[model samples]
Target: MVNGVLSPKETIWGLFSATFYTNVRANLYLTGSSSCLFLKSDHDDTYLADKEGTDYRYEKWFKNYSAIEASGMRCVKILDTYELTYSTRPDARVKGINMLRLPELYYIITEYYLSLENQDEAVKYFDKVLQSRGLTGYADRQGATLTLEKVIQERRKELICEGQYFFTQKRYNQSIYEPKSGKLYPASNDIYVFPLPENETEYRY
Candidate 1:
């Protein structure tokens, strides 16, 4: 892919976008959280997303307390694990906010549309994703003529069993029928949380 786009020497590094990195970093700092301190850059306005996992935090964690006082080390280890999202070659690394954030879906969808050569609409949706760092919920899809099949495929790939699948299917007015039963269901105002496994219930006693 790098050869297709640029020369072999011109490898693209540093996974996340500036806006995404800035947003998550600001959120971490504002929340008084140091969970991302491992990925923190020594210099500003430049990227260090390609750097290796820094064990400095771990060293600090160990030095701060005795063997019995491991809570500090645990916290530091959590931060360290969270920031170690990059690979040595820097392809597509996961972002720190992936657990609590769904921004990547918007970014990927915008890229997919752009690949289809719908430049104007792609730019429109891409801009929406760019501006959506502050906006809540889904973007306004009113009057937008998108390819439902492709969008649904992307949504499936991104969301899967992350608990948004049914709602996304319903949003597109796609059939939500049970596969074996072939029963259609109405949309609910609230999301449906799946019940625990039978094994869990059986072991409760």
Candidate 2:
């Protein structure tokens, strides 16, 4: 979004990056807690910052990392606790799209998934959930059919400037046990949600 444009993008994705990036600074060791953040800028292209300095933020701005790679291991462990076995649907694998930059596409799908109170959206959410897609994966198939739309946007509060706003909106709602506070933030209400802006720093040599 532009500096003065405080509105959400009407589209279904939020892909463009920002000049100002933010990072979290922890005050103490894990009691499962953290504090104030240190913000900087991509005014160039800098690595994104994290919330509380925990790796969980990785799952927010990133679609690929150890957390996702290990999600299956954790799920399997939980499944085992039930003394239950599991099976992958024949459609369990999907073609990986490692390069796509449409964030709204991801935001909408994740929204629909979290909003579903029933399994009605389960098939749509994870018919073949274990695919390594980047961006286009979420929007490649538009049809009478439905699917899981990987959950990434809302999970990325710690990922500001890493590209999260419109795509996340109110979806992928990762509750804040403690509000995410920062030094370089706008008003509280303003920070809670967002409006999409355009990428201003265009190619210049």
The global C-alpha lDDT for each of the candidates, from Candidate 1 onward, is 0.37, 0.29
Candidate 2's residue-wise lDDT over 61-162, tens digit each? 322114421211111100111112243313322211112233434444545665674334533443222122222232244442332333452233322433
Cα-based TM-score, every candidate: 0.26, 0.25
Judged by lDDT, which candidate is best?
1
Worst lDDT 10-window in candidate 1: 1-10
Task: TM-score for candidate 2, please give it.
Answer: 0.25
Error of 1 at 132 (Å): 19
Q: Per-residue CA lDDT of candidate 1, range 18-56, in tens?
A: 354344333222232543222122221111221123323
The CA root-mean-square deviation of candidate 2, after full C-alpha superposition on the true structure, stands at 17.3
